[model samples]
Target chain A: DAGVTQSPTHLIKTRGQQVTLRCSPKSGHDTVSWYQQALGQGPQFIFQYYEEEERQRGNFPDRFSGHQFPNYSSELNVNALLLGDSALYLCASSFGLAGVVYTDTQYFGPGTRLTVL
Target chain B: AQRVTQPEKLLSVFKGAPVELKCNYSYSGSPELFWYVQYSRQRLQLLLRHISRESIKGFTADLNKGETSFHLKKPFAQEEDSAMYYCALSPSGTYKYIFGTGTRLKVLA
Candidate 1:
């Protein structure tokens, strides 16, 4: 019954360095989405992965990439990070059903706090 | 462009008083709206969605397509209801959701 779980609850990285945050979707969930939440701001969608392929992406740049494993786990990787990248990275999972339905409800993880020093 | 807006950054109300959090959205096509709440030390979770047309924890929001607004309202505010509320909208052709800046609700006793 465990919900979405993320690894390395907190991470510290220097500017220009790369970092990878991991997430395991809730049990029985398939679709995984990544979001970035700056301090005092709501989350912004980065991208979404389904069946190991990115189905949709937000307005983020190519420096931000993600991979979804067959196990439904996901990893968010950011390259040449900037101070602006220092924010809480949230991972959400859902059934990826079409339109609005109970299955479309996205369950979110506690989130990984990334600090770019 | 799809966008969600929560005009109020902070809302304070005395406990037991009525509370309302306003939300407005801009979208060209059919959109699905949702209200997500994050309590202190808690994960961000879905409070309710327009499609469900259901209320949760005594909070209800009505989606007015004509006005492009979905405002969350509660009859009596409780300290436990204090949290960060985000308004999100999903466009008709995409699964991506756009969220507002969020409103922080504070209920004082």
Candidate 2:
């Protein structure tokens, strides 16, 4: 398996513009999660999707949203981007079981480098 | 609020020297802790998880619930071990993870 794959290795946008990043989960994986990593900082969880529904969310604002398709692929959408939003957007996939913490081992992709001007 | 902290931004050690990357967390309840590593030009990957109690690439971490720390350590560091290390915390029954700012380990020759 290719593990996890993300599209558009890099992106550039201006303030108030929107952006969408895509991710394909590892083979047989059913859960996908999104994270944002600012330069020199660790990744921060944005949210997670399972069964095509958002299962959990982090402390991010409403402008950051996501979707999971039936094929287990996922997309992260950032609306009205700001300079602060420029960062590496990461997508992780895992086999999820409700209320099961051990199955939450996530495999991450190369991540998309988003630069907002 | 759940949070993970890796106090040191960078750590340098000579090859074959001992290495330790400090990680601390703040949370209530039983949490699952993990260490993640990112090599240059590579994706971030899991190094080890507390629940598994296993070591990866000569690194091991013991979760100290009392002190709320999960420090990664290796007796003999190698040049290949140099990378960015991150400590993460996942609350029980939650999919979200809280990650530390990360420590950049540089093993000099």
Candidate 3:
């Protein structure tokens, strides 16, 4: 099923510019979650989407937002990016609704490496 | 606040030696813990979860609620086992996961 897939394996952007990263969930999965992993750090939860709405959000700033389409594909949008935004953006997919039995086990993609110059 | 911590930034062990990756968490309610592994040039994948009580690639972790630690261990490490390992926690009734900074395991030949 190719599992979870993300677009643009790597990206380069300047400060104050905007960028959008895309993700397609695994087959039959209905939820998508976004995470940011800085170099030498683990992945930090950004937000989660289910049923086309944001079900949960992390402590990230308002500049980081996301959307989920009907097919469960998701997009992570960052506005006015800062140099600190340079990191590996990861997209994870899981089955069932949030807090469900199987939702906590997520499958991750290759991740999009975003570099803010 | 919910958080996960992996104290060691890097761990080196000889092939066939025992290995342990330490992880501690801070959370109020029942926590679902998971160990994730990322091999070189590969995506991050789930190694094991506390609920399932199963081992993957001969690695197992026991969630000690008393000490609030879920440490991953393997009796005989192999060269293929070298990778970055992360400990994660999902608070009760939530899907968001708090991950540790991760430990890089290097199994020398």
The best candidate in terms of DockQ: 2
In DockQ, how does model 3 score against the reference complex? 0.77
Per-candidate Cα lDDT values, in order, are 0.94, 0.94, 0.93
Error of 2 at A98 (Å): 4.0
Estimate the TM-score of every prediction: 0.96, 0.97, 0.96
Residue pairs in collision within model 2? none
> What TM-score does chain A of each model score against the native chain A?
0.94, 0.96, 0.95
- Better-scoring candidate (DockQ), 1 or 3: 3
lDDT of 2 by residue, A5-113 (tens): 9998999999999999999999999999999999999999999999999989999999999999999999999999999999999999999886565546899999999
Q: Rank the candidates by DockQ, best first.
A: 2, 3, 1
Candidate 2 lands at a TM-score of 0.97
The lowest-lDDT stretch of 10 consecutive residues in candidate 3 chain B is: B88-97
What is the docking quality class of candidate 2?
A: medium
Candidate 1: deviation at residue A45, Å?
Answer: 0.1
Error of 1 at A55 (Å): 0.3
* Residue A4, candidate 1: C-alpha displacement in angstroms: 0.5
Q: Per-residue lDDT tens digits of candidate 3, residues A3-112?
A: 99999999999999999999999998899999999998999999999999898899999999999999999999999999999999999998874446444578899999
